[model samples]
Target: MTQPDNTDDALIRLFNVSKRFGAKLALSNITMDIHKGEWLYVTGPSGAGKSTLLKLFYLGEKTTSGQVLVFGTNMNRLARREIPFLRRRFGIIFQDFKLIAHRNVFENVALVLEARGEPRAMIAKRTRNILRHAGMEMRMNAMPTTLSGGEQQRVAVARAIAGQPEVILADEPTGSLDPKSAEIIIGLLSAYHKRGATVLVATHDTELLARREGRIIRLEEGRLVSSEPAVGEAP
Candidate 1:
């Protein structure tokens, strides 16, 4: 499918992007644009390269060929010292909820702001507010191991948004949650997107696609198969 045409509004652009792990090709010739304030769903079956595509955005995995441009900067040419600064512009949520094991829920979220050198008072206030929104305030002092999968993921979501990042990249965020928890997670993401943050969700959950309206891009065997609006959605 032809991709979006408004280059002026594009926050991320991929041109002939491809990734290979030894003999295994993870992504191939991915050329597209992710516009600012857009909510995009990346859907595919297992081993279809959904996660790898998201990784390229945050620099988790380097592409073997082609370029990934974020905020007008080419990721392939980014300097080592510049990576952390570039990553601060993004909020990434992993399926496993990569919270610090020793840090409590509040600390886990607070650390993001702290790393950015935010003032102590502001960090405390924002952390509390974000956790409250995620329904994790009550468990502020609880460690990752103490919280259920749903609770941990909630904390992960809270941490991701604490910095008010311009973009959010979530990989299988609701894959292991219960139906209600999944709904809650999606709701939180949708709320963030409504606030003008770009959101890219990698998921294979049909129920999730049904619950939300957005542009959907499907991948198969490392290649983009389709890019279109959801059924009943206005293009």
Candidate 2:
């Protein structure tokens, strides 16, 4: 297996990290580094620990052994109260597009800025801009349940990016969308990555990987099998 990147300036680092659920070893001896302003793809079959890996970065799941460091702090030792602060530095997109059914698109997107205590006017302005970018401006007042799958995902994207986080962790972001919708989602992420945010996408879609250019890492049975640049790219 190829060695994981371990540069000094890594924004996120996983060192010999392992996670177990009961008797199942979900992730094994993983060591990887995510650098600032880089786009990374984590690819593997279902249950290969792709989602678990992303969760570990944001503290959704703890490692059974070893350490996960993000933004210079060891997550294994971070206080519960401090997790939220660290999460604020990350924008996470889930496969299910977990939007609140009762909240309108505008409210959903604005909640992030509101949580950060931004001025109401600023929140309104930024939320509107982000919705427009996600092509959800017209649906801003609509409930998430009222939107189509693609539309709802767009709203989720808007919500994820409203805070301008330093890192974006997307887990199977396009797994359920049509080709066109998936393209839009990938486009949004690509645009975000261009703005200097580090992006880590966990997907098993070969077509999606074929269409994007980034470093690719493959996992098999919880073990990292390869880490290499995209095809046609230089090492």
* Most TM-score-accurate candidate: 2
- The clash count for each model shown is 0, 0
Pairs clashing within candidate 1: none
For each candidate, the alpha-carbon lDDT, in order, equals 0.92, 0.91
Off by over 4 Å in 2: 1-4, 231-234
Q: Looking at model 1, how many pairs of residues clash?
A: 0
User: TM-scores, in order shown?
Assistant: 0.96, 0.96
Q: At residue 163, what lDDT does model 2 achieve?
A: 97
In candidate 1, residue 51 scores what lDDT? 96
Give lDDT tens digits, candidate 2, residues 115-184.
Answer: 9999999999999999999999988999998898889888888899999999999999999999899999
lDDT of 1 at 125: 98
Using lDDT as the measure, the top candidate is 1
Residue 4 in candidate 1, Cα distance off native in Å: 6.2
| Per-residue lDDT over 1-235 for candidate 1, one digit per residue giving the tens place of the 0 to 100 score | 3454656999999988889999999998888999899889999999999999999988999999988888999998999999999999999999999999998999999999999999999999999999999999999999899999999999999999999999999999999999999989989999999999999999999998876578899999899998887567665
**Model 1 CA lDDT for position 78:** 96
Poorest 10 consecutive residues of model 2 by lDDT? 1-10
Judged by whole-model lDDT over C-alpha atoms, candidate 1 comes out at 0.92
